[model samples]
Target: MPLNNIPADRSYTDEHEWIMISPGQTSVPTSPVRVGITSVAAAALGELVFLDLPEVGSEIEAGRTCGEVESTKTVSDLYPPVSGEVTSLNQAAIDDPSLVTQDPYGSGWLFEVQPTQLGTLLTAQEYAEKNGA
Candidate 1:
């Protein structure tokens, strides 16, 4: 993938998760951040088979395992980019876990979190640079 194609607006983790501040009813300074597996991660995981998601309103801590994602090759923990309450989870992805590999940065989002602390994450450029993009 082209390094330039990495969405400039979001932050990424080495674990292959992408997180962006969701544009809430307000300006989203303190609103939830949408969480999802990155295309790189999705591609590496192969076809997704199942997604174990957390319930809405679940208090999750930053950098902790909030759920699990089972793929054709392996089962990986879904980590939160930031610590906060889970506002919502994508039922569509739950029903069709393959959506995670289909559109990793879009409708395949895992959950929305109202962050209490932004964990150690990297910007798109930073991630690209770190990964030799």
Candidate 2:
């Protein structure tokens, strides 16, 4: 899918990050959100070789470095689109870096999060527009 075609139901950030906001408010002030690398980011990285994800329960801040991926060309850092504690990582991607190259938006997702700040993200459409996608 084109990055500019952001789902209206979701939000995005300037850094080309997308957030899938969960329905309903919980103990946390806002809905929990899932984060993943943008299609643009994955494409630029080329074929991935290694992914270094944080352990679950680790606190992450918006715009802060959280992880890294080593591609055929170079290593790139993973940035958190929102502040939160990591809830999960894609085990498949950890096992096979190629998954990130093939399906970045799906099974290649790097992490799920319980966002501490929901306002830090942008919708898919917004990010796409800014990136000229």
Candidate 3:
């Protein structure tokens, strides 16, 4: 289920990832933006133990497995909500995977990308409903 606190400020993917738009940017973005797993995903994963992040300069597609997140309960693939070239990987999250469970939306961001596929993303409301929040 989606959390009400999942900010209405940006779009979310059905795969449970959230896309945070960079400041000063609006719709149909082509510049780098923050990306992270949602709280609902963090909770389901259960006690994150490791996170494999895509390298900068890597090309990723929306809905395609880009990396992985390992939790005490399971290991799960991480998907980008929109397709783009990865511009940066969060060294902080890689260094301390537990940060993902502690703060999935903020300091736990997975990557930055200059998105090329924003058209497929869902609004916050749509994500919430689709997830049965």
Candidate 4:
């Protein structure tokens, strides 16, 4: 699937996750970043039916499986693009999984974390090229 709408402001992972460091937060190590699966992943997963996200205050490792997303096609593990404590979850998306595919970058965001460190990440252009999107 063509991902023509990858946002330029955030960094992407090879696993198809995206992380957006909070705006106005210059220090990434302490900033709370928003995390979610990319449109490419959402499309590949087909229609989502269930979402299990990490609880707030839970410590998560970058690139590690933190939760799961179940779709009609398959059940996929959800990975955080950066490591830290989960600050919050998007309850709206949890309640309505379609929001994840409908608006992956907006209301579909999965969770937020105060990052302790970052993992390998690519710019939007790099991600597009890597995925052939």
What overall lDDT goes with each candidate model?
A: 0.81, 0.72, 0.82, 0.87
Candidates arranged by lDDT, highest first: 4, 3, 1, 2
In order of appearance, the predictions have TM-scores of 0.87, 0.81, 0.88, 0.91
**Predicted candidate 4 versus true structure: per-residue lDDT over 11-50, tens digit per residue:** 8889999888532334556567789999999999989999
Q: Which residue pairs show backbone clashes in model 2? A: 11-122, 11-123, 12-121, 12-122, 12-123, 13-122
TM-score of 2: 0.81
Residue pairs with backbone overlap in model 1: none
Taking every candidate in turn, the Cα RMSD to the unseen true structure, in Å, is 3.6, 3.3, 3.1, 3.2
| Native-structure RMSD, model 3 | 3.1
What is the TM-score (0 to 1) of candidate 3? Answer: 0.88
- For model 2, the local distance difference test gives 0.72
- Model 3 lDDT per residue over 16-126, tens place: 998886322346575698899987899889898888888899999989999999999999998887788999988988999888888988898899989887635777777
Please say which candidate is ahead in TM-score: 1 or 4: 4
Candidate with top lDDT is 4
Please report how far candidate 3 places residue 112 from its true position, in Å. 0.4
Please report, as a residue range, the 10-residue window in candidate 2 with the lowest summed lDDT: 22-31
What's each prediction's clash count?
Answer: 0, 6, 0, 0
> Candidate 4 lDDT (Cα, whole model)?
0.87
Judge candidate 2 at residue 115 and give its lDDT. Answer: 76
Selected candidate, larger lDDT, 1 vs 2: 1
